[model samples]
Each structure stands twice: as C-alpha cells, then as structure tokens.
Target: MFRSVLVANRGEIACRIFRTARRMGLRTIAVYSEADANALHVREADEAVLIGPAPARESYLDQARVLTAAKATGAEAIHPGYGFLSENAEFAEAVMAAGLTWIGAPPASIRAMGLKDAAKSLMVEAGVPVTPGYMGKDQSPERLKAEADAIGYPVLIKAVAGGGGKGMRRVDEASAFLDALASCQREAASSFGDDRVLIEKYILSPRHIEVQVFGDAHGEVVHLFERDCSLQRRHQKVIEEAPAPGMDEATRQAVTAAAVRAARAVNYVGAGTIEFIADGTEGLRADRIWFMEMNTRLQVEHPVTEMITGQDLVEWQLRVAAGEPLPLKQDQLSIAGWAMEARLYAEDPANGFLPSIGRLDHFVLPDDIRVDTGVEAGGEVSQFYDPMIAKLIVHEETREAAAQALADACADIEVWPVRTNAGFLVRCLEHQRFAAGDVDTGLIGAEEAALTDARPSDAVIQDASDLLWRSRNVDPNDVWDAEYGAPGFRLNAARVTRQTFFVDGVRHQAPYENNHPVVRYGPQIDGGFVVFHGGDAYAVSRHAPRGAGGGGASDGSLRAPMPGKIVAAPARSGDAVTKGQPIVVLEAMKMEHALVAPFDGVVGEIGVSVGDQVAADAVLAVVASTS
Candidate 1:
C-alpha cells in the first residue's frame, strides 16, 4: 500500500476517500480553492494546501497546481475523486510522469472512452452492442440536420465530450433541430470546451442500468452487479438502486458478461462503470439493452453497490493502484441485500428546480441511515460548485422497505434558509408507480406536477403557527408570565391572537385563543424556529410587517430569481415580447434558468447585458403593458 495519498477533489467525495485512506493507515492530503478554504474536507484531511482561486479552472481542474500540491505534501498517489480532473487522460499521464501513482484507470483506457463518437466506434469494433447513431466528424450544420432526419424525429444531440447531461438536447422534429443544436453546442463549448456533438436515436421508455467493473494489473476483471439509475431529471440521476428491481437471472448474466467484455476490450484497470440504456416499454431483457457510455472513475452512486456487495470501492481503487491483484474473482462476488440512494441537492422544486445557495442554518439528517455529506450546519452552499448537499443511502432486506426508509429519511431532513428537494424526493419515493418499480427515465417528467407539488399538511402548518405564537408571547425568563397579556385574563377574552409567517413565500396567518395550549418547539437557530408535531417538522420564519417605503418595483418587472450570470439577453429594450416569452437566460449552479415576461408587453429598460452577474431579485428587464 502507498504511504500516503492526496485527494485531488473537493466536497463529500474528498471526505469519503479520506475516511477509507485513514482506516487503512494511509495519511491523506487535501487540496482546496479559496471558496473551500473552511470546507469540511480541508478540516478533515491530515494536511491541506491551498491551490488557487474559487473557480474550478483555476484550482481543481488545474493539473500543474494539483501535481505540485501532491508533490509538496509528499503524497505517493493522487486519487481524482470523480468530476473535475477524474476522467482527464492528460492529467492521468502527467501524474504517472511525475513518478506518482494515479489511483484511476490507465490513460490509454481513458483516452479510448473519452470521446463519445470514438468510444462508440471502439465498442462496435470490439463486438459489443452499441446504440445506433451518427459518430461522423463532419461539422457542417447541414450534415447534422441530414443525420437527424435519417435517425427520425425525437433524436438526442449529445456533446462528443459531455457527461452529467450538460451538453445534451432532445429534438422532437426537424423544425426544432437547428435551435436545439445551437443551444447544445453553446452549452458543450462552455462546459467541456468542445462544441462538436453527435446525433443519437433517443430511446423512448428508457431505463439506465450501469454495471460496476474493476480490473487489476494482472488483466483480471470482475463485476459488482448493477445499479438501476432510471430516476432522472434533466438527464441527471436523482435516485439509484442496486440489483435492478426487474432484472432476471438470464438478463443479468448477459449484461454482466457484456460489461466484463467491454472492460477487457480497453485493458481497463481500476474502477470504472459501463452504462447501458434499456428499452423498458415491455420489460428488461437481453435484446433491448445497448451500451450508452462508460464512466472512467468512481461513480457518485457507488455506495448503493457497496451496500449490496459489502465492499469499499475506494479501497479497491487504492489496492489496484498499488499493483495488487483482483480482490475477488467474478464467482466470489454476490449481492447481499437491496439498497437505494437519493441525491439530496440544495435546489427548490417549486421554482423549476432552480439551485438554492445560502448558509445551511439547520442541517440535520436521520440517524438511521447512511449519509455522505459535504456541508454542515454553518457551511455555505456556494455558486462555484455542484449544489448537491449529500447522498442518502439506505439498505434493507427488500426493495420496498429500502424505498420507504429512504423516503422517510428525506422527509425527516431539517435544512433551513437553503431550499431543498427533500419534500420532492419523498414524493418520488412514495409515488405509486415508483413504489411498484414501474419506472423509467421519464418517470419524473411524467409525474412532475405531483412529485414537486408537495405541501405541508394543515396539522403541520398549525403546529408551526402555534410554536411561533408561543415563542413570540411566552417569556423564557418567566414561564408563568405572558408578554402580551395576563395568562388568565387573555384566555377569557373572545378575540384571537394572530401570528403571521411566510412558509415557502406564501403568507399565512394563524389565529389561536389565548387559552390554547403551548406547542413545544425545537432549538431556535439563526432567528428561525423548527417546530415538531405529529412526527413531522416544519421550519417557519416570522414574517415581519413591511415597513414604510416598501412598495417599489412594478409587478411586470422580470427580475433575476437568483444570483447568476446573464448568459443571453434575447429581448432587448423596446422589443415586443409575448407573455411567458423568455427575456434573458441566467446561468447559476451549473444550470440555466430562463426569466420570462410576466404578461404581454413591450420590453422596457433592459438593465442587464450578456455576461453580467446580477444579484437576486435584481430587475433584468421591465415589461410595460402594451395597452
């Protein structure tokens, strides 16, 4: 084993890697940018080094800085913990060149599977089934259009060098081809610095199934079963499970064999994932599955596989990088139990799932399950990185039990000031279709309204109101005395005491009799109170009365919903736009949000330009009534 290893990443993955390294008695080093100076990963490492500024390009993605930090810290190996430089073939080669062990697949393997088009061609040549698509090099717009026409409508335009759904668009018809292509290209160039893309036939009723494969220096490879990651939103996985719900013995053997073949084709070493897309319109079978792509590093959802197989993937990575043979042969590995993982992100489902950035005033998770988190109570979710707060994983004897436990765990989370999809996740897990395992990639989209429309029950709302009233009126110094009125006399009065609050932007007034029993409240943090009742918790903030001079902007103003950079301003000043027409596109938290006009009107004073960063609620443009 190596004496020490440096984690060339940030957040939960960094912390996760450190845990395994420390358990193995290996010293761990962490590298951080200015934004993550006080981050949990930095505080947990044995030694830490500041690399560069907050932006990834200046820090995490900078190969020279990372290599220097590793060398300075005397780290014998560097673990690229997914994302950033994890899949960069050049970075891997550079690490090897510096005489430092790279705890990832060989650079040759990474290069082989780096580009989508080239990787598909390689898979085809290797006799592995691949999705039928256009992998040509022609960059002409006409050529792409012709390819799209040949592939038929409802084709997917994917960036040649893209992952995490950044540079992907689905075109339903020829009329939308050019526009979708432009948007896909723009995002691809911005994300991967490669605007080139390929057209693929979009699979309807698609189910994403990926097999976890590991290889060693001795040309030995084995499989760790599979994970069903069909629950997705915007092409990004939201929930994942091991031992796919509907997978049978015959299909499993076929897919696992194919995955091993794919790994051997590249002479792959270390941890990698072979993702396959299945046609679930009928049911999971051997014939309907085709190779989609391969992730050349540890996956975000590897924990589910870990829970079912009773193994640490990071440990495997370290052992293999040290030139050790395979830990176990293919026949030795087997699934134990069912496991599920839900990615908890700091995003608001009510607001089109826009990313929320703020201090985590009250970060708490259920104690019953395993939670891999990056931020704590006082940590900040910044705009410079991914908004995922944590990954909640649960295991049980059965899939239904695991799903229910995961949903309950999500609902039990108490995070304040930073909006999350916790409630939405609960809804998804509890949905009838999801519970029955009748799911696919389009599940979330098909039931989006129900999944995102979860609201607190009336009893929970009343509990919050009661807690707020007691906190405001009851004196902590003297429990017997009431600040508003005498306890006995107030109870005799007929009028009710009204307490106002804003629960998710909607104003609510709770009227209660003075004699009403005081409801118990949890610890108060940052002037906000968390109320618990009926086995549920609600975080409510007192809505202070608007002071004088509050009335300001008109209702027709199109404001930036959150702090972000203006990527495009399609409607200029004096340009006429219809209701719901997009005025500007804002980029934040690595996603695009389009701000649209509130009503049919003419565009007035455009306050922001392309490439300008604006604060939350800052008016980007005003839509004056046409009448």
Candidate 2:
C-alpha cells in the first residue's frame, strides 16, 4: 500500500477520502483554495497545503499548484476527489508524470470517456444499449436540425465535453430547436470551454440508475451493485438510493453486466460509475435501459452505495491505485439493505432553485442518520462554487422503511441562515409515487410546487407566538406594564403585539400574549422558542439580508437569482416578452440559469450584456407592464 496520498480537492469529499486513508494506515495530504483555508478537510488531513485563490480556475483547477502541493507534502499518490479536475485526463497524466501514483482510473480510460459524444459512440460499438440518437461528429446547425427532424421532436442538445447537466437543453418541439441549440452551445463554451454538441432523442420519464464498478491494475474487475438517482431537477440529482426499488433479478443482472462491460472496455481501474437511463413509464426493464455516461471518479452519491455494500470505496480506490488486485469477485458483492441519500443544497427551491449564499449559523443533521457534509456552522457559503451544504444518507432493511427514515431524518435536520431543500426532500420521499417506487427524472419538476411548498402548521404558528411573547422580556414574570426590553419586542400594555413573519411562504400573524408567565402556543412550545418554525431555531442566526440591485428595476423588474455571467440575452429594449419567456441566461457555479420574464410586457431596458458578471439580486433587465 502507498504510504501517503495527496487529495487534490477540498470540502467533505476530501475529508471523506482522508478518513479512509487514515483508517487504512495511509498518511493523507489536503489541498485547498483560500476560501477553504479553515475547512474541515484541511483540519482532518495529516498535512495541508494552500493551492491558490477562491476561484476554482485560480486554485483547485490549477494543475501545477496541485502537483506542487503533492510533491511538497511528500505524498506518494494523488486522489482527485470528484469535481474540479477529477475527470480531467490531463491532470491524471500530470500526476503520473510527477512520479506519484494516480488514485483513480488510468489517464487513457478517462480520456476515452471524457467526451460524451465519443463515449456514447464507444459504448454503442461495445454492444451496450445506447439511447437512439445522433452521436456523429458533425457540428453543423443544419445537420443537427436535420437530425432532430429525422429523430422527431423533443430532442436533447448535450455538450460533448462535460456533464452535470451543463450545456444541455431539452426542446419539446422542432420550432424551439435552433434557439435552444445556440443557447446550449453558448453555455457549453462558458462552462466546459467546448461548444461542440450532439443531438439525442430525449427520453421522457427516465430513471437514472448507475452501477458502480471497480477494477485493479491486474485486470480484475467487479461490480458493486447499482444506485437509483431518479429524483432530479435541471438534470441534477437531488436524491439517490442503492439497490434500486422494484428491480428484478433479471434486469439487475443485465444492468450490472453492461456496467462491467463498459468498465472493462476502457481498461478502467479504481472506481467508476456507469449511468443508465431506465424507462420508468412502463416500469424498469433491461431492454428499455440505455447507457448514459460513465463518471470516471468517485461519485457525489457514493455514500448510499457504501451504506448498502458495507465496504469502503475510497479504501478500495487506494488499494487499486497501489497496484493491488481485486479483493473480492462480483459474486461476493450483495446488497444488504436499502440506502437513500439526500443532497442538502444552499438554494431556494421555490424561487427556481436559485443558489443562496450566507453564513451557516445553525447546521445540524439528525443523529440517527449518516450525514456527509463539507460546511459547518459559521462557515460562509461563497457564490464561487456549488452551493451544496451536505448529503443526508440513511439505510434500512426495506425500501419503504428507508424512504420513511430519510423523510423523518430530513424533518429533524435543522439548518438556519441559508435556505435549503431539506423540507423539499422530505416531501419528495413521502410523495406517493416516489414511495411506490414509480419515479423518474421529471419527478421533482412535475411536483415542483408541492415539494417546495413548506407551510408551518397552526400549532407551529401558535408556538412561535408564545415564544415571541416570552422573549418580550428577559424576566418572564414581568407584567404587561413592565418594560419588555428586548430586541424585536416592546412594552405594549394597551395592545397585543402583532407581527407578520414568513414561515414556508405562509404569512402568519403572531399575536404576542400580553400577560402570561407560562408561555404556550403549540402544545410542544412550553419550554422552547416555537418548537419547529421552519428548519431549526438553533440554526437560525440573523444576518443582514443580501442587497437587491442589478438589472433595470426603475419600474420594478425581477433581478438575477445569484451571481453569474450573462451568457445569453435573447431580448433587448422594446422587445415584447410574455411571462415565462427566456429573458437572460445566467451562468453560475458552472450551471446555466434562465431568467424568464415575470409578466407579459415589452423589455423596457436591458442592463447587462453577454459576459457580464452579476451580483445576486442584480437586475439584468426591466419589463414594462403591458397590462
């Protein structure tokens, strides 16, 4: 085994790898950006090094800086923990050239599967069932239009070079294809530096299932079962579970076999994931499943697989990277239980899932479940990176039990200051269709409103009111005439204090009690400040609200959701735009966001041009009210 390994990444994933490395008796080195100087990963590592500035391009993405960190730290191997430069073949090659072991797939394997168009072509040739689409090298607009026409409407335009739903668009009709193609191309260029795209038949209601595979240097490969990642939004997975629900023995065998084949075809080593889009409309079937893509590094949702497999995937990656043979064959691997993982993101799900940035004051996950997180309380969530807070994972003997457990755990999770999708995740898990195992990629989108619509019960509102009354004075026994000296409170001997505070979009009138030594609103609010108001009270620390500016809002225009560069503005001043019409496309955290017209009107002013970096709530444009 390698004596030491350098992790070329930051956040929870780096910490995750370090834990396994330490357990396996290997020294671990952690590299971090300036933003992550005091991050958990750095504190957990045996050694730490500063890479560069906060921006990924200047730091984590800097290959030379990572190599220098590895060399200076005296690490024998480098582990690219997902994201940043994990899948970049150039970085993998550089690691090997630096005379250090690359704790991941071979550089050649990464290169082979780096490009989506190229990977799909290879999979098709290898006899893996690929989605029927145009995967040709032709980049002509006319040719793509022709392919879309030939394949019929509702085609998908995907970037050839990157994944994570970046540079991807779904057009339901042929009339919308051209505009979507240009938009996708621009997003592709902005995100991956590659504008090349490929048209594919858009699969409706597909369940994303990926099988994890591991290989060793000695050519021994084995499958580690599969994970169901059907719940998603904007093509990004929100929830994932292992031992896919309702999967039969035959289909399981076929999917696992195809995944193994894909792994061996690339002469892959270490850990990799073979994603397949399964037809959920008619339920899952071996024949209806098609190859999606192969993630050449440890996946973000690997915890679910670990929960079910009872094995450390990171440890295996280290062993394989150290030129060890497979520890067990495929036959030895068996799913022990159902495990579900919910990605907790710092974003507003109701407001088009816009990323939110702030200090996490109250960060608490359930003790009963396993939570893999990168951020801690008081940590600032910057706008420069992905707004993921943590991942909550739970394991149970049955799928129903696991789903319920996850829902309960999510409800118990208290994260304040930054809005999260925890409530949304709980609703999804409790959703009837999801509970029944009838899920698809469109599940979240289809039930977007209900999933995000979090409302405090009457009991909760009552509890808040009681808390408000009690917090009026430091001395609970103070009379109504007595000075109720406290912030957000005043001595109101003549009248009840009425305040309007939002809880899960529900406006509540919390009438403070005028005289009450014993505070009570909700039955459970006897001792604490409103027992379940929104997320968690301990998680609620007040901070200055983000300033709203940007765009042109003289007549009240909707602003940009978060900080990002304007990649596309199809509308200009005086152009008529209807509600929901695409006005501007903002690229942030390596994801494209479409700012649609709030109401039917003519574009009064366009404040930003392409390539403009905007701050959160910065108005990009204003629309004159047509009504």
Q: For model 2, how does the per-residue alpha-carbon lDDT over 1-627 read when each residue is reduced to its tens digit?
A: 779988888887887888888888888888888988878888888889998998889999899999988888888999999888889888888999989998888888998998888898889888899988887878899999999999987888888886888788888888899998998898788667789998888888788999999999898889999999989887888999999887899999999999989998999999999999888878889999999889999999999999999988988888888887877887888889899999988887766687888887667777767888778888878888888878889999999999988888877766655778877887898899999888998888888888877655556565555565555444434344343323334456544345554443234675555433221222222223223433423211112123323334445485877777888888889898888888888888777788877778899778999989898879788888788
Instruction: Please give the CA lDDT of all the candidate structures.
Output: 0.86, 0.80
Q: Write the per-residue lDDT of candidate 1 for residues 409-502, one digit (tens) a residue.
A: 8877877668888888888998898999999999999999988874666656676666666666663223254543333334445533555686
Worst 10 residues of 2 by lDDT: 536-545
TM-score of each: 0.92, 0.90
TM-score of 2: 0.90
lDDT of 1 at 517: 38
Candidate 1, residue 531: how far the Cα is off, in Å:
3.9
What does the lDDT come to for candidate 1? Answer: 0.86
* Model 2 CA deviation exceeding 4 Å by range: 473-507, 510-554
